[model samples]
Target: MSRGTDPYVAGAMDRRIALAHEWDELVERVRRLGPRFASFLAPPRTQDFLSAVGDGTAVLINVARECHALLVTASGVTAVPLPGLSAAEIADRTERHLTALRRTDLAAQRVHHTQQRARVRKVPATYQAHHAAKIEMAEAQAELDRTLLPQLAWLWDTVAEPVLRALGSPARAGAEAGHRIWWCPTGLLSFLPLHAAGYHDGSGRTVLDRAVSSCVPTLRALARAARAPETEPAETDKLLVVAVQEADGMSPLPQVDEELRLLEDMFGPDRLTVLEGPNATREAVLGQLPQHRWAHFSCHGRQDPLAPSTGGLLLTDGVLGIKELGARAYNGDFAFLSACMTAAGGLSLSDEAITVGAALHYSGFRHVVAALWSIDADTATALTGDVFGSLTRGGRFRPQASAAAVTEAVIRLRNDSPAHPSRWAAFTHIGP
Candidate 1:
């Protein structure tokens, strides 16, 4: 367990050897309680992990602090050099992005409040009533873009580009389709959008162009997802649409009805169930979730940085937190969270991957499409239509092709709004 000539490698091996010894002792104590407990406590074997990821997928584990990114493929793991990356740089970028994001969120809330006021007054929004809020939101959005563009470029220059080149990806452009890469970014890197890292200078030199990206909390999580029971493509039929157009104390998602209509047209009433408005209670949604193979939630989502478990989709009755979803077991194929910040993990718990999307994936939803930040309502609706339309192309719900569908939808969104990175770069696909 401690075989290494280099001093740095030897020290790491030595530490691992000590950990293994400690684990063995712990296992021995747990064995007396139950075999299951002992087995659960056992460390992962190298061969098992290698088999789990398969040949087509590669796992990039960005460890804590300033360190080399570890690329784990079916063959083995290798450290990839990231000369331009540093802990300080990642921390600074994370801070800047989050700061801008908070400002944008506040502005959005103010806009929502103004709309709520006008609705209560039984009057249409006047130019003066809506002008200031809109201006504030626009300013915040511009600042967000200003922070986002540079951070994305930095990530590409420092992390993504170097790793892709090392993986034999073409330096020029045009990466082959269908290749998947699971990014396990820890520490400050977790909050950053690894999937959207690029120059965006019309060079097509981005992670989106290079490969389909996913996020995993840990290798153990990936292993569990890989071991989930597989079903025939045709078996995945039912679609559960949880649409909360207007939740109590939350901004109304005006586009949710249109999104539901589009999905209904695609999936039909026979294979789809829509729980909207007053019907989308937390209990009802949770009860319906197990019966469906695919799920779509079009509602307001909240993320509590201090308490991730408290963060969830704003339903008609209450919040359906991720903790609730993670507690249940499901053999589902896909979940589309067309809500705000479903994939945004807490900054404090950066390495934990505590987000609604992660909860669903770990609970056995193999493929999840979620937002990294608050998304424009119209853009969300349009993207939902486009993504689901692409998924159900031959009159079938294809969950395995989720990443490709997301990529296509995002490209279309980007083409439509070339300057607004916030609208296009918000959504991320996390799965095989």
Candidate 2:
């Protein structure tokens, strides 16, 4: 299983082999008890069951395949299929079946999880090694997805299909934002162009920034046009801020305190309220909603596909996990998330649901706004200031206005110092 000419390849190959060993153990247990006779069959005896199946050694090792298929299908794994055959063949089939299953759904989850975990934190020495191993892992993952997950999906479809289908059925219009903090893991943020957004890595921040500048106005106008007549857009709500930042000391963006104060003054301090952030949970935030329809924030937010534990928003004294977002119920129509990685989600931007915008939309806010990529704080703060300032001047907060305000603000900031054109151009508005 560890056969490889290259050392790096060999190490990765060794990991797969180790996985096989674990699979082998699972199979051996299957052969001893048969598939239908899973330890869960008798009762809560995984302990005694595991011990009883011991000593099969080679024979047990072979059963891993069929056992995998049966257990995966059995749901809750109460029983294993009892094929009318000798123990050795049973073991072999179980092992082989598992090998096949491992080649499918379980494999895909494993691969994605592995890659996601690897990306959780970057390590310099492990960088090259990781990229190289990723190729191998991707191959293995592909083979497993192509081979195993389909079969498992079929099995699930055959068994629990009805219940699952009926359960996720969404209602008309869309799911209500009923006081619950909606969490779409891996939500899309923005579509800004790279150079326009500025990046130290020389990546596509410009392309992404341009996408933001170009799209924000269009989306904002579309939303306004789509109004249901019950609500009209706000002119003082012109701030189309797209901020991506982590919480500092478990608190929302502090640099924006001055800007937020300015907004309170312009939009009316009574019209705005700062809910939970670094120290608050989603549940705490939904306790109250903006009856006035507009709101702003200077907080921390995170979106990571593989690390939900590390994903959350900053209140004041603590971080609110996205997993717990469903607890908060939002009633406001418009909102903003000045947090980091708010829009990052699955590899495909569209499929990602972790952005604050998606959460707001899912919760009930019709004209939710958001950001896509990471942003520069001072620049973002300055742009946001311009936005509120424009809105207070009665300029419509439509998509174009929002976009123009953000862009022009950045332009003005840069014009103030021709040498620093890159500073204020990092923020963009993601309109709904």
Candidate 3:
């Protein structure tokens, strides 16, 4: 009964050898089909394909209760496991943070209203009530901090630190200047701010500190975008700048004019097509989209939680829903959605990839810069101007330089307004 020539073991080994050969043949066929077609085929879970992507970038895919950090470099890929980080927990924390943020915004508004009332002529009877309300708001905020800080710390420990460690701690001393990461989060994790996840333990351990963070819906999307054709130079490229300062019943954004003016100056008047107020209608903007290589939207954006695909940019006539964009094929390469919730997704349908930014990507824009929440008008203008300026300096346009340029611009804004995450962290680059 010696096992030296066991028939069962020998047969199993032969089958495995044959399967290996079959797999190699399949892979070779996919390679000949091209990157776009090969993307549809599931890649092997091993590190063999990492060489096909860019250097110094890692792609983290979060799923269910764990994260798979695929460290991609010019040489190879390495998978790092991040366990015990459940999607449910991430979602709960995100919702809690958003609630706290809304409460903080309301408190600020109340304080401003009280100040306006005081300026007019405060009544003695109402003064005591207003002061009491302010105190109550402060106490509520303190309570919220007690709940929020711990969750953020947990995320840093469980999620961000592991990913950074896998990427060889790009934040460490003497690391190269342009380290980048593309986060492809699942479920509610997509809505959470992965870039800002860190504890406030006096140690700068945040993702923003470590690397420039960008997002893509899938690894396939990132690969596709990386291979997309380059846009024409700014001098020759056509840009469609749409600003809906007043759209029906929505609040007007007068600062959009400033954003448009800055963009016009950079792109030059002949290269720019300006659409504002009544002219920035749904049909008009959609019609003009195919003719331009770039588009900048400075208007209100809405997210429909009930039907996520219905969410879109609010134009003068109506909403330019994702459904409409899906029907068209445009030649645009970049889209800057300077609007509220352009990157936000419905909690229930978080995996649908239906945000305005995603829609623009589907509509053939290789790169999209969008907001995760409502942004301050002045902050948006400043950030956009700096980003585009960095891109077009020396009269040369470099689309490949966008990620680093955006990170630099946001860091500058963060330095100026350190306490306000709403101003800096809200905007995110959503593609290559």
The models' CA-based lDDT, in order, is 0.82, 0.40, 0.73
lDDT of 3 at 116: 54
How do all the candidates rank in terms of TM-score, highest first? 1, 3, 2
TM-score of each: 0.88, 0.42, 0.78
- Residues 1-432 of candidate 3 have per-residue lDDT tens digits of 357878998888889999999998887788678765564456544343353356656565556545666667767767778786766677678778667656755674565566556657768756765686588667655655565556556767877788777667755421125357777777777776676566544466666666777877766667657667775464427779999887664556767989988988887878889888899988899888888878889998887555777788998889988889778887667788889888887767887767888888876888888887667779999988998998889975555677777777877776685445566777788777
Question: Across residues 98-133, which tens digit of lDDT does each residue of candidate 2 receive?
Answer: 354334323434444555546775666446555655
Which stretch of 10 consecutive residues in model 3 shows the poorest summed lDDT? 170-179
Error of 3 at 279 (Å): 0.7
The reply for model 3, stretches above 4 Å from the true place, is: 1-52, 65-67, 72-77, 101-153, 172-178, 199-202, 231-236
Residue 419 Cα positional deviation in candidate 2, in Å, after optimal superposition = 7.2
TM-score of model 3 (CA atoms): 0.78
> Residue-wise lDDT of candidate 1 within 1-432, one digit each (tens)?
335478888889889999999988877887778754655666877776687778645556455455677888888888887778888878887888888999999998888888777667755554357668989999999999888888888888888887887787654443236356778887878888888888777787888777777777777787777877768654446999998988887777889989988988998888988898899999999999888889999999999766777889999998999899899988898999999999988867877889999999999888899988999999999999998988889976788788778887887787687667888888888877
How does candidate 3 score on lDDT?
A: 0.73
